[model samples]
Target: MRKRVAVIGGGIAGLAAAVRLRDLTPPDTEIIVYEQSGALGGKLRTGELGGVTVERGAESFLMTGADGAESAAVALVKRLGLGDAIRHPARVPAALAFGGRLAPMPGGTLVGVPGDLAQLGDVAHADAERDHDAGRPLLAEGEDVAVGALVRERYGDEVVDRLVDPMLGGVYAGRADGLSLQVTMPQLARTARVEHTLRDAVRAAQRAGRRVPGKPIFGAVEGGMSRLVGAAAAASSARISLGLPVREIARTAHGWRLLLGPVPAPQTDDVDAVVLAVPASPAARLLSGVAPAAAAALGALDYASVALVGLALPPGTPLPDLSGFLVPPSEGTLVKAATFVTTKWSLPGDGPVIVRASLGRAGEQERLQFDDAVLLERAMSDLGALLGGELPPPVASWVQRWGGGLPQYAPGHLDRLAAARAALPPGLALAGAAFDGIGIPVCIASGERAAEDVSKAWEG
Candidate 1:
C-alpha cells in the first residue's frame, strides 16, 4: 500500500517536516503540505527597498546549538545545498538604550543574565549580596519558573528591566516576567536544577556552551531568508496546496481523515499520518474533538503581536558604528529594538544604509492597531530620539505587521506539552514554534522530530 502523509501549515516547520518525511519514508510515500496562507514562508518573508534586499521578518538564526554542534537550521541549509550562501554578520557589538543614553551590551550574559556580576558596568546594577547560596539547588527536578522571577530575586529589578527584558523582548516580543526559564534559557534552567546560586547557574550554563574564539554566533542567507525557504520547499518535493485551511481532523480505521477548505464547499484528505504545524488556536480547534486535553492545553497558550519597519537611508548616512540597540520596556517607547541591516551584514552592493525597527511587545496589541503610515512615523520618531538627533527621511520604507505571531511559553509549558503529546493518538503529531521554543533551528528540529514520530507510528 502506498503511504500518504499530510503536513498542515506551510510555514518553515511544516516544510521542514515534509522534507524529513521524504527523506525517512519510502520513495513512493506521498507527502502533501497544506498552508492556510497563499505564501509558504510564514515569518521568513524577504522584501526589497531602495533597490536592495531586506528581510521583512526574521533576519538571521543561530549558527550553532548549545553543544557547539551545527544547529538544525544550518544543517537544513547544507542539506538543501544552501551552505555556500550562508553569510555571517560583521563583528560589531550591539547596545542597550536606557537612561537616555546607549551603553554597550554586557558580555558573558545568558540572554542578559550576567554570568559574571562585574561585567554589568553601568548597564544595570546587580545586587551581589542577594546571590548568596540558598543552601540547596535553585530548582527541584521537573520544576520551572519565569526567567524574570528568578533573575529579579537574585540580581534586582534594575537588571531585569534594563538587560533581561530588552534581550528577551527582541526575540520573543515578550517580557522576562512571563517567559518560562525552561523554554527560553534551557541551559541555565538545567544548571539551576543542581546549582545553589543564580550566578553560579549562569556561569555553569556559559561554561557548558563555550564557543571557539572569533566564531560568528548568527548567520543569514546571502540573498535573503526567502532563498532558504524556497530551497527547503523545493527539496521537500511535497504536493503544495496553498490558501487551504485544514478545518478538522479525525481518526479513521485505516489512517486519519482531514477536513479542509471552506465550510460550504469543504474538502477531505485521507492520509496514513498527519502533522499539525499550525499555530496554537487552530491546532486546538482541530484537536478539540480528537484530543480534548491537548486542545485545552494548547488553547491556553497566548501569543504576542508585533510590527517591523524597514528604512533605507541614502548613501553616506552617518549612523552609529554599532550593529544596533535594544530598547527596554521601561523606556516607554514604541520601538523595542532596531537592527542596522547594512552595517551588520556584508551585502555586496553599495546600496543605501538599511535600518529595521521592531515595535509592539506582548500585551500591547492595541498599540499596533494604527495604520501603516502612522506606525512608520512613530518608529522613525523613536529611532531619531534614540540617535539623539532627527534622522534624514528615508529614500524607501516598508512596514510588516504580524498579529499574534510569537507564542508565549508560560511556566510549566513543557510539562503541559508532554501531557498533551501523551494524550494524542497514533499517526498524529504536532510541530512548530507553538509547540517548541521559537527560533529557526528549534522550529526545524521540532518539525523533523514530529516527522520521525509519525513515521514510527506508521511503521508500528
Candidate 2:
C-alpha cells in the first residue's frame, strides 16, 4: 500500500499541508483530512450583509519576505485565480484611537515601535518623549513584554491606553499583557537579535529594501477570505471528512491510529503518519496519550475568546470624521477596535457601508454576553460617540464567536515553539497557529513545512 498520512483539523494549516503533500509526494500517496467543523479554513471566514462583505475573523495579511513560506501563500492565491481578489497592495491609513480621535500611525513605525527615533519623540507624550530620548526602549526589544507595557514605556501611557493596546486587542481578541510580543511582533525582535535597538533594525530593513512579496505593506483579499478557503478545498485530492471529531490519537506499531466519532458512534482510522493542527488547547487534549510532552507544551500556550459585531449601514450614511479607532488597554471599554471597512476596501457599487466593531478579549469575553440585540446596541452606542452622528440602525447585523481562536504568543515563544517541535516524534509533526504564526500565510507555511519534514523521514 502507498504511504498514508492523516491530517487533523481543517484550518489553513491542515488544508495547506494536505494540498502541498499531494504536490510533493508520489502520485499514489494517500492523505486524509479530518475537520471537526463542517467547513474548512478555520478562522478565515467572511460574512455577507445586504450586498456588503465583512471579515469577522482575520482583517488583513501583512506582506513581507519572499521566503519560501511566503511564496507558497502567493502561489496558493494565484493558483486559485484570486490575484484580482486581493484588495490591497500594502497597509493604508491604519490609525490609533487616542484621546477620542484617530491619529495616523507615525510614518515609518514598524510594529508600533519606531524604527526612526528622530521623529518618534515628536509624536509622543511629554514623559514618553524623555524615555525615547534616553533610549529606554519603553517596550522590551527582545524578550516577551506585555504589549501594553512596552508601548506605554516607549510612547507613554497615552499611546498604550489609547492606541497600541486597543489596536492589538482588536486583532488578537486578547489582552496585550496576556499576549506575547514574540508571536505577535516578532519583526521587532529582529532588532534585538541583531543589535540592541529596534531603531537600528528598521534602518536595516530599509537598507534591505522590501523583504516580503516585492512589497512592504499589508493587505486584504477581494471577494472575502471565504472564497480562498473554498478554492483550496476544491483543489485538494485528499479524502476530506468533515464534522468527524477525533477523540484520541494513539501510537501503533505500523503507524498511528485515530479514535474518532462523537460518543455513541466511535470509529477509527490508522494511518502511517499524523498531523495535529487544531487550536493549541484542543490539540493538547487530543494528543495527551501519544505524545505527552507535545500535549503538555501545546496546552501551556494561552488562547483568547473573541467576538465580532458586524453592522451594515444604509447607503450614503455619514461616518464620524475619524478614519478608524483603537482601544488602548487603559480604555476600560469592552470594545478593542472598530474598522471602517468601506474606507479600508473598494466597494462593488454605491451600496451600504460595512463596519465591524470587535469586542471581548480574554477577560472581556464575558462582555460578549449582553445578548445579541443588547450587544449591537452597545456597540453602536459606543460607535456613535466616535462617529458623531445618529446614523440609522444597521440594515443587517451578524454576530460571530470564536472560542480560543487566536493563540497568545507570550515572550520566549519561539524558544517554546522550538522546544515543542523538537519534542515531537520523527514521523509526527505539528502545524497551525499553535506553532510559529497565526495568520493564514504563517499557518500555511507551518503545514507545508510539517509535511516536508514527515515526507523526508518517511522516504528515508
Candidate 3:
C-alpha cells in the first residue's frame, strides 16, 4: 500500500514540509495539506491596490548566506523559475521619531543595541549612566534574559524605549522587555555573557572581521508574495484541502488518525506520518490527547496581534524620500511603523502612491478593536505626522488584521521548545514561527526540517 503523509496547516512552513516530504518519500506516497482558511499563504498574502498587487502581510524577507552562497529562499525562488522576479529594496535609510522630531538612526547599532556609546548622543537617557557592573552577571549562569532589561541595565531606559522597542516591534510586534535576548539576537547574547559591555563586545566582533560589505540583505517577489505560495503548492504536488480544519488526532494501529472538518459532520484520514505547521495554540489543542506535556508547553506560549493598513494617496504627494519611519512606543501613537510600499518594491501597475501602515503591538490590542474606518483615521493621523502634514483622502484603503500573528519569544523560549520537542511522538513533528525563527526564510526552513524528521522515523 502507498504511504500517506498529512500536513495540518497550509502556511509556508506546512507547504515547504509537504514539498520536502514529496521529494524524500517514494513516488506513490500520498501527501495532503489541510488549511482551515479558504486561502493559502498564511502571512504571505497580497491584495490589489491602485490597480497593482501589493503585499498585505510580510512584504520582504531577509536573505541569509555566507558571502557568495545563495540563501535557501533565493534558491527555492530560482528553482521555481522566479529568479528574474526578485526585486531588491531601493537604497534608503529609515528614520526614528525621537524628541518630537524625526532623527536619523544612530550608526553602529544592531537592532537598537548601540555598538559605540559615544554615538548615542541625545538618544541616550539624560540621567542614564552606563552600568560598568554588567560584568558582575545579573542573569543566572547559562540563563536567558529579556532583551530590553539587559539593554536598559547596560545603556539606559531611553535607549530601550526609543531604539530597541521600535526595532523589536517591527519584527515581533512585541515589546522588547518581554522578548528573550538569546532567541531574538543570538550572537549578541553569546557575546554579552563574556564581554563586560555591549559596546565592548560589538568592538570585539568588528575587530574579529564580522562585517560583510556590499551585500543585499532583503528580497521580495516581483509581483507579490502570493506568487511564492502558488509556486510552492505546484512544486509540492500535495493534495490541498482549504476550509477543512483538522479538529482531532488519535493514535492508530498503522500510524495516526486525523479527524478533520466540523464537529457535527467530520472527515477522517489515516496517515503514516503527520507534520503540525500551525500556530502554537491550535497545535497545542490538537495534541492534547496524544502529547499532553507538549500541548501544555505550547499553550503557555503568547502571541501578538497586529493590523496592516494599506493606503493609496494621490500621485505626487510629498512624502519622505526614505523607506519609512518607526514610531517609538514613548510617542503614544497607535501606529507603530510605516513602510513606503511603492518606494520599497516594484508594484504591478502604477495607479497611486502606496503606503503601508502598521498598528498595534503585543499589549496594545485595545486600538485594534475599532472599526476599519476609525483605524484608517488613526493610521492617517500618524502618517500626517510622518509626512509633516495631513495626507489627502486615500484613493484606496485596506485594513488586514492578523490576530495572534507573531509568537512572543519570552525568556527561556529555547528551553521550552526543547522540552516540547522531546515530548512529541516519534512520527509526529512540529514547525512554524512558534518553534524556530520568525522570518519567512526561517519558517520555510523549519517546515523542511520537520519533514526531514518525519522521514527518518518512517524509514526506521
Candidate 4:
C-alpha cells in the first residue's frame, strides 16, 4: 500500500511541509494540501494598487545572518529557483516619531534594547550607579520575562515605549508587555539574564565575535511575499484542494481520516500521517477530541487584529527620503507604523509613491472597527504630523483588515507548546505561527520540522 500524508492548511507552514514531504518521501508516497480559502498564502497577500504590485500581509523575511544566505526562507527561495527574484531594501535606517519629530534610530541596539545608552539622546536613561554596577542581574536563572517589562526595567519606560514598541508592532502587531522575552527575542533574553547592563552585554558579545558581519538583515521577493507562496505550491507535486475546509479528523484503521467540505456534503480522505498547520483556534478545534490537552492549551492562545492601509500620494508630494517611521504607543495615535513601499521595494509601474500604515493591535481592536475611509483619514493625519505638514488627498488607497491574525506569544509560551506536543497522537504534528514563531522563516521551519517528525514516525 502507498503511504499517504495529509497536510491541513495551505499557508506557508503547510506548503513548506508538503514540499518537504514530496522531497523526502518515496515516489509512491502521496502528499495532499487542503486550504480552507481560495488562496494559498494565509497572511502573505499581494495585490495591485495603481497597477503596481504591493504586499498586504507580510512583506519581508529577516535574514539569519549578515550574509542572508543561511536562512530557511532564502534556501527555500533558491530551491524554488527564485534567487534572482530576491530584493534587498535600500540601505536606509528607519526613524522614530519622537516628541512630534522624526528622530534617527540610535545605533548599537538589539530590537530596541540599547547597547549603548550614549547613542540615545535623552530618550530616558538608567540610573548610572545601577547601570555600571556588577552583581545586579536583570533576570535570575531560569526566569522568564516579558520583553517590554525587561526593557522598561533596565532602560525606563521611554526606551521600551519608543524603540521596542515600534519594532514589535511591525512584527507581532501585539504589545511588547504581553510578549515573552525568551520566545520573541531569545538571544536578548539569554543575554539579559546574565548581564548587568545591556551596553556591556552587547560589547562583550561583539568582542567574542559571535555576530555575523556585513550581511543583509532582511529580504523579500521581487513581486511580493506572495511570490514565495506561489513558488512553493508550484514546486511540489502534492495534490492541492482549495476552499475545502477540513471539518473533522479521526483515527482510522491504518492512519487518519479527514472530513472535508460543507456539513451537508462532506468528503473524506484517509492518510497514514497528518499535519495540522492552521492557526491556534482552528487547530485546537480539530484536536479537541483526539488531543484534549493540546486543544485546551491551544484554545488559551489569543490573537491580535490589524489593518494595513495603503495610500498612493500624488507625484512630487514632499516627503522624507527615509524608508519609514515607527509611532510609539505613547504617541496616542491611530497609526502604529508606516512603510514607504516605493522607497523600500521595486515597483513594476511608474505609479504614485506608495506608503502603507499599520494600525491596531492585540487590545486595540476598536480602531480597526472604523470604516475604510475613516481609517485612511486617520492614517493620513498621522503621516502628515510625522511628515511635518498636511498633505493632499491620496490618488489611490487600499485597506486590508486582518482580524485575529497575529498570535500573541505570552510568557511561558514554550512550556505551553511542550505540553501540547506531549499530548499529540502518534504520526500527527502541529505547525504554524502560533507555535514557536510567527514569521515566514520560522513558519517554514516549523512545517519542515513537522514533516520530519511524521516521516520518522512512519519509518520507525
> Judged by lDDT, which candidate is best?
1
Compose the digit string of candidate 4's lDDT tens values, residues 146-249.
Answer: 88886676667777888888878878887889999877777666766677876676565444435466666788988788888988998778889999999889
Shift of residue 441 alpha carbon in model 4, Å: 0.7
**How do the predictions measure up, each by TM-score?**
0.99, 0.89, 0.95, 0.95
Model 2: per-residue Cα lDDT over 163-216, one tens digit each:
456556766766556566667766554444454344565566455444545453
Ranking by lDDT: 1, 3, 4, 2
Estimate the overall C-alpha local distance difference test score of candidate 1: 0.93
Task: For each of the candidates, give the backbone clash count.
Answer: 0, 13, 0, 2
Please write out the lDDT profile of model 1 over residues 1-460, one tens digit for every residue: 8999999998889989999999999999999999998999999999998999899998899999878899999999999999999999999889999876778899989999998989899888988999989799999999999999999999999999999999999999999999999999999999999999999999899888888898889999888999988998899899999998999998899888999899999999999999999899999999998999999989999999999999998877878888999999999999999999888885543689999999999999999999999999999899998899888999999889999999999999999999889999988999999998899999999999999999999899
User: Could you give candidate 3's per-residue lDDT for residues 382-426 as a string of tens digits?
Assistant: 888766788999899999999889999999888888989999988
For candidate 1, give the lDDT of residue 250: 88
Candidate 4's C-alpha lDDT?
0.84
Give the CA lDDT, 0 to 100, for residue 291 in model 4.
91
Q: Total clashes, candidate 2? A: 13
Error in Å for residue 211 of model 2? 6.8
Clash pairs, model 4 backbone: 66-215, 67-215
lDDT of each: 0.93, 0.71, 0.84, 0.84
Candidate 1's C-alpha runs over 4 A off are none
TM-score of 1: 0.99
Q: How far is 5's C-alpha from truth in model 3 (Å)?
A: 0.6
